[model samples]
Target: MVKRQAYQPILITDASRSQHDQLRSRQLRYIVMMSIRAACLVVGAILVGVKPPLLWLWLSLCGVGMVLIPWLAVLLANDGPPKEKYRLANRLHRSQRDETPPRSLPAEERPHPVIDAEQ
Candidate 1:
């Protein structure tokens, strides 16, 4: 397992520890998936050997998992974590906010005065 720094964003394409960590995480998931697949196969085989006809349907399902798991694992292993996503609020600095228009628009925009003069 790799340690990530406190502040910096991890670039998906960078050849850094962050990318390697992402791959490691994915491999860990694949390991769990494959472990479960193997367990299913073993159990299915055992049941089939004891009484062949009864477990045939289950064994077929296990075979399907055996065939598909490797393909899925390879695809997952190649996948990288998504690039850092910063929202509008997080991206803009307080200084930048000063440049933007105020909450209230110009008086001309509203036909009626927001505050009535008569009290």
Candidate 2:
């Protein structure tokens, strides 16, 4: 029995990527939080005049969501690309056109093809 190889991960290494991606993600988070805050504030204002019982809980959740936005942004920003992808792609592209052909599956085996039960 032959063991199959695992697929490699992608790499991302543009210097500005980390900075720009972080900044953009943070900006998006801030915008979303601010919009939600404004919405809740408006609702609270309208409800305050009539004394809605659920206003306190609604305002509390919005406040907490506003406070957590930046932390969430940071988490989103930290998931950038790995460092090995560019090198691997280059190696694959080079190997494809080189004098030596790309590697082949073992000669003794043929891969299975899927069949549709309906057919």
- For TM-score, the strongest prediction is 1
The residue ranges of model 2 lying beyond 4 angstroms of the native Cα positions read: 1-18, 62-102, 105-119
Question: Candidate 2: deviation at residue 33, Å?
Answer: 1.6
- Clashing residue pair totals per candidate (backbone < 3 A): 0, 1
TM-scores of all candidate predictions against the true structure: 0.51, 0.37
Name the TM-score of candidate 2: 0.37
Worst 10 residues of 2 by lDDT: 110-119
User: Distance (Å) between predicted and true CA of 64, model 2?
Assistant: 4.1
Q: Tell me the whole-model lDDT of each prediction, alpha carbons only.
A: 0.61, 0.55
Error of 1 at 28 (Å): 0.4
Looking at model 1, the pairs that clash are none
Per-residue lDDT of candidate 2, residues 8-36 (tens digit): 33333222345567677766766675676
Estimate candidate 1's alpha-carbon lDDT, on a 0 to 1 scale: 0.61
* Residues 54-80 of candidate 1: C-alpha lDDT, one tens digit per residue: 476877888898889878878887776
lDDT of 1 at 27: 84
